[model samples]
Target chain A: MLMILDYIKEKAEFINQALAETMDQLEGVPPVLKESMKYSLLAGGKRIRPVLVLATVEALNGDEEKALPFACAIEMIHTYSLIHDDLPSMDNDDYRRGQLTNHKKFGESTAILAGDALLTEAFGLMAAGAKNAHLPLDVALTIIEEGARCAGSRGMIAGQIYDLQSENKKISLAQLEQIHRLKTGDLIAFSVRTGAHIAGASQRTLQALTEFAYGLGLAFQIQDDILDVIGDQEKLGKPVGSDQEKNKATYPALLGLDEAKRKLSVCIEEAKGKIREHDEIRPARLLEIADYLLSRDW
Target chain B: MLMILDYIKEKAEFINQALAETMDQLEGVPPVLKESMKYSLLAGGKRIRPVLVLATVEALNGDEEKALPFACAIEMIHTYSLIHDDLPSMDNDDYRRGQLTNHKKFGESTAILAGDALLTEAFGLMAAGAKNAHLPLDVALTIIEEGARCAGSRGMIAGQIYDLQSENKKISLAQLEQIHRLKTGDLIAFSVRTGAHIAGASQRTLQALTEFAYGLGLAFQIQDDILDVIGDQEKLGKPVGSDQEKNKATYPALLGLDEAKRKLSVCIEEAKGKIREHDEIRPARLLEIADYLLSRDW
Candidate 1:
């Protein structure tokens, strides 16, 4: 288990490096705009989504190299969302990942353009990846379309809209679940499913992986909500009780902290159970990820 | 000539309808956000880029249907840039294409998201187009990469950065040309070239088209600069002298109005000259476009 954890970490680092190199190509941009994108992108996170993509592909005995572009694309999409979410018109966050947000480092206009650049570049990278991998055109096309759906209105954007409108309003637990599933879960599902699709996994296997991702994603968001209410700011790298301060609805707000934690545990268990039918090689790394995410203090 | 013009108009209207239908598929976005995207996108414009794409494809004797998705994709990209440029953080303009800007109608946050959504959806549309056309993977990949380059840092975004930084500065005529060429010329070139490539045009044809587009694009920008300094606001649908008021550099500022107009004429002639080697079918429509662009009074 420890070895598997270390392996995932190494692969995550590799994906992060690839992401940096891909973003570094934007150096041709004016120094200010390029720096703005780099400031937020390189500020560093766990690179969990990219890792999930790499790990899932590896578990399916797929070429890790072939999956690298989609991994990078997913991270770019995630980064763009963070940048926009931190803007004054949105969440208005000044700090992200324990540093000044993109808008604070670069003016709002540059930040906005940087985010747009990242999102557009993600598609370019994905297309280049398809060429590099020699994948079937249909496969590459499917991945691009599905990835966009996950990131666009029916997915993350919709989740954000719901989040914004739900602010300061008391919403039901089902509505909260819908928001998180779309906002957070859909992308995670895409990360795993995209890898599986690239690897040409059996439809049955891909379906199970998706269910596993869905449960894990929900668990991840619930843990996040619990952390917001009770976690330490030092570890979380963000102010605690921010959700409460902003009257933002969360799993904890809907289910209470204890209930949220219990639900998270159940989600983790269910996610692991969904993948049990898979061979040891394919499910082991993802199961470990579910454990790590649900148990993390931050 | 009239028959071909009618065919082009019919295709353009079909492309417009396709674009509108595709945009209407943006489910789950907030009504306000959806309205914002639609408001700018549906606002009447010439649909020039997409029309150029279809025209190039037709001129190459390729199936126009195969190019439709790309046609819509370029327009989406163009619209997204306009939406972002009209934001308060950027140009701060309240009007575009004779209508209120996206930011004015939807607020800054929604406008930003609308742009993001449009850009993301463009990729989705391109992928779908690739699938529908049954083109080879490499061709589809190239189209996506070229489109991304036209929209990203070294292309439209870079142009915007320089435009912002050069505000209030006394830039040389050469510097102004570089800015507009990157901001506007690169994408227009990409629009023509992508269509040709998708149609499997010869290297010689692609090269000739690139030169033609560059000349035409430069002329287009010079005409815009000239219009801003002298045109009536009611006809232009926006206030004139906006560049002067904002201290933004323009061709007229560096080259005088008469010189700018003369330069535009030279550009139009050069653009037409490049395509003279091609069959009459290729140069005819493009030359007509150049003339129409330069002849516009507002």
Candidate 2:
């Protein structure tokens, strides 16, 4: 467990340094906007998505350098979505990770532009990655298209709109699943699958990785909902009960707490099952992540 | 002139049909979201940017089919920016093209998501174009990077942020020009240059095309300001003098109406010169469009 944790920590550090360097290289973004983007991007997090990308590459014995741009690109996309979701016009989140959110710290207009810039920069990085990594044109094109599709209207944006419109309304579990699948699952799956792509993994390997990502992504969200209801504020670094306060639906809200926990366990189990299928060839990192995610006893 | 006009009309018709078909083919986008996206994208405009894309391709004798995706993508980007700019958090305009703005038609959240979708979809289209056209990896990568850079923070979004920050405030002529160049000029120039790129034009041709686009983009904005001051509202299709009402800076405000007009002519002349430099091999459409844009007598 500790070894896997160390691996993630190292990967996270690499991602952070790369992200900072990328921001420094932005030639034309205004300084203020750049600052806002960098601030949010550099804010400490688990860096799980990026780790998944690199670990998947490791599983396939692919060039880690070739996947670095993709790892960083995923983080940029994640940060941009966080910034936009925190806007007053969107989720109205005032604080994130115990610090003032992007809009709170940098004003609304700059925050908006910062998010826009990050989103743009991510795609630029993805395309640039194709050239920098010497990946085949079709593969690079596929990655770009998948990344955009997962994050765009029919994907994350759609989830957000559905989430917003479902406010104060009774949303069914199926509808909630649809929203989460779009909002969180799609991007997480893209991250896992994209790494597999960069590594030139087989279709079978990619499918298994995607299945693992889907299960893990939902379980992660479910854990989030559970934590929100019963979490140490000092450890969590953010307030709890905000979802209920906002009249937003969540796993625990729609299903009973016990049922939600049961679902989380099921998802984790399924994810592990998928990872175990590739046990001979897959790296231990993916399995470690899946197992560690559900174990509450730290 | 008549020939070029016919060319533009034909191109616009093609773009319109392609855009309509594309919207209909979106797989997972919700019906309401699709409606919102189509409503804004299909709304009639001059199709100037898309036309420039194809015209430049034509000028270079490139495959029109290869250029179609890019042309559609640029228009999508243009539409997305307009939708976001009209949001209540930004410019707060109620009408666009003599119709209710996206937000006014759909709810605010839907409109915002629609814009996001369009923006994301546009990137997807660019990548897809690379595969469809079988362009070389390097060229495809370059197009994607340039598109993202021009539309992202350093370009259009930067202009938007500066414009918002400068609201109701005194700004210098150079500052206003900076804003316009970033917001309007960059994407316009990108549109023209990208088409030249698709044609595999020489560096000299690309540079000349870029110079023409830069000059023409700025001049187009200047003419817009002039129209706001004195042009007929019915022909313009939306409320005039809104920039002045918003206390936003404009060419007429900074350069004075007379000086602005003189500068507009200088820009037009400069743009024509760039086009004429390639007269031996370049298509006449580029020069004709440059001349036709500012000429009131259709």
Best by lDDT: 2
DockQ for all models? 0.74, 0.76
Clashing pairs in 1: none
Q: What lDDT score is found at residue A101 in candidate 2?
A: 96
Across A131-242, the per-residue lDDT of candidate 1 in tens digits comes to 9999888889999998888898778887887888888898988999999999999999999999998999888888889998899889988988898888988787778888
Candidate 1 lDDT over B1-298, as tens digits, reads 5654565577678887988888777666667667777887778676778888877887778888888888888888899999999888889999888988888877887888888888888898899989988988888999898888888878999999899889888888888999998899988998898889888988889999889888988998998899999898888878899988998888888888898889999989999898877863366666676777778776
lDDT of 2 at A191: 91
C-alpha RMSD in Å of predicted model 1 compared with the true structure? 1.8
Task: Report the C-alpha lDDT of model 2 over A1-298, residue by residue, as the tens digit.
Answer: 4587677788899999998898888887777888899889998877878888998888888888899998899999888888888887678898887789998999876786687788888999998888988999979999999998899877888888788878899989999888888888998999998999999988888888898898988888888888888777666667888888998899999998999999999989888788686843465778888877786421
- lDDT per residue (tens digit) for residues B82-181 in model 2: 9988988789999887789998999776787788789889999999888989998888899999998899977999899888989999999999889989
- What C-alpha lDDT, on a 0 to 100 scale, does residue A14 get in candidate 2? 90
TM-score of each: 0.97, 0.97
